[model samples]
Target: MTETPQRPLRVLAAMSGGVDSAVAAARAAEAGHDVTGVHLALSANPQSFRTGARGCCTIEDSRDARRAADVIGIPFYVWDLADRFREDVVEDFIAEYEAGRTPNPCLRCNEKIKFAALLDKALALGFDAVCTGHYAKVVVGEDGNRELHRASDMAKDQSYVLGVLDEKQLAHALFPLGDTVTTKDEIRAEAERRGLAVARKPDSHDICFIADGDTQGFLAGRLGKAEGDIVDESGTRLGTHEGAYGFTIGQRKGLRIGTPAPDGKPRYVLDISPVTNTVTVGPAAALDVVGLTAIKPRWCGTAPTGPGTYTAQLRAHGGETEATAEPVDGELRVTFTEPVRGVAPGQAIVLYDGTRVVGSATIATTTRATAGAL
Candidate 1:
């Protein structure tokens, strides 16, 4: 069977000053698309340089992006969306933590900044699609519906983060790095072959806005210091903390608790109540959660009408577990086949059917497996 030839499109390629994005733009241009490279100025006061690859959105990164666009032989421009990014991603992150929830800012950025704001602006500018180097695929079905799927490289697969995209956003999305099953080294090699300079550039890690990767310090600065009590499951005061927002569920270290567990076992953060300004620590077994309730669901295609078997991913780099999920009363309720540990509210719960993305929602609450449930 002969495949239909793809018509050239007016593509807006998002260049992140990294090898992956540079090569993605190059490939899009090579495919006969009218590609224009763009870098989003997501920081209000961009740093002069990055501290290794620990963060991004620096002045140095913008310059690197310009150089990559020059090598790709495409028109390049930087769009200032720093205000939107601060409001949508950064502030939302702070607020989530203040409410005693663990939020994934990357997923929120993809949903709000890249796909929504960027795609909307691109469409207004007559661009047919917004292309990126994300390690995920946008598969078009026989009925002409676009479906988000995992990339060929499972190790670098990023479909979980892209699960928040709805059908409209997926329609105008292009992921040039998704179809290849190459390793990170191979991608760097390809970038070198193409004369792109970021081939050896270190991949960005940790939270981008948190330059030093000290999330506790960052939150403390923003939320201010409020002395709180650290207690065990039995309501016995173990120690004191500067703030309740400094800890997360399943956290095992930096507890600074003066007292040790009665059974001499390592304790983990079991609960955080901002209202009471209390941080609760207990055994790891008490962290097991059997079910969850999620809100603000976003689907890639049609919403599921009935309960269905799916694999749920609780974290960006975490493993998936078998679950039965259904959408009821504008909320997603999921029951895991087995108890899972360290489940947290405010984190996104992405559902997948095989390699295809089902949808995503912000986890609002969880049902604990043990009798000592909070």
Candidate 2:
């Protein structure tokens, strides 16, 4: 864990009504800091109860957060950020899909809502720092700079999603749970010992806004139906689909194509073209990506001046791959040492120097490896 200040500071804990956040807030308060708990009301109309933890921002979650704050003896309040969340996260998600790309809403929420909007508001209120339950560390470097690093428990490390944080944001962030090299079950036990009611609460999963976990249905409702052709690499029509936006790169299960490949192998979605209103399908080999160009890079500390070798994580729950990355123009250009599969546009590509996060960017394009390269 990063060394806590000897002097007690004012901390605004963002309690997300989970066991993790509740415990995090408790630890902050116990550290002699003046702590206040606040839960974000992300949805305008929150559901009564979550469907087995498939979603969050429900009415029950707010109540659970309030109870946890009470148990911790901290002042609690609800912040209505529904409008900001809808505009920044929900709308951005729809727009990305409509543009034939896949976006990670969790990253957007961390960047825009949690760190940007929430931190700005906290600073205006004279708060010293914003504390959360994210499983990532903020280490004060020898040069007096704050660096973002992965958690001790690699299984629960959330550094990939938090790569969007810049140097300014890192200076005012606190993560109390990052250094604990214990299993999640032990954390729950700690919460129980602390009398936090959320000790047994299930962790939220999937896209929170889409409660049913039916992403295709959600997109269909917003984008409506625009029937398009599902074609092959050679532009040969293999089948048809209701909407091209519904498919993502490397998706294999729902292609619904009646025609099989020449080798009778299952086909996967290779590309989506919104301009042509087409969804291209081919064998899985075509999904191998050798290089990618990403836009709007955000560095945790200092930006890299030249090309460097680092491990790149393409998705939130994905494994890292060795890559050489450099800043070119205003974008990040990365070439993987070995081809990686299922890399999609609009997704975040986070670079790390071992356990420390280097930066992150939104993937705009990908270069596929040669045929049979994989």
Clashes of each: 0, 0
Model 1 stretches astray by more than 4 angstroms: 1-5, 48-50
Location of the lowest summed lDDT over 10 successive residues in candidate 2 = 47-56
Candidates in order, TM-scores: namely 0.97, 0.97
lDDT of 1 by residue, 261-283 (tens): 88999999999999999999899
Per-residue lDDT of 102-192 in model 2, one digit per residue for the tens? Answer: 9999999999999999999999999999999999988877887889999989999999999999989988899999977867899999999
Q: Candidate 2: which stretches are off by over 4 Å?
A: 1-6, 48-55, 371-374
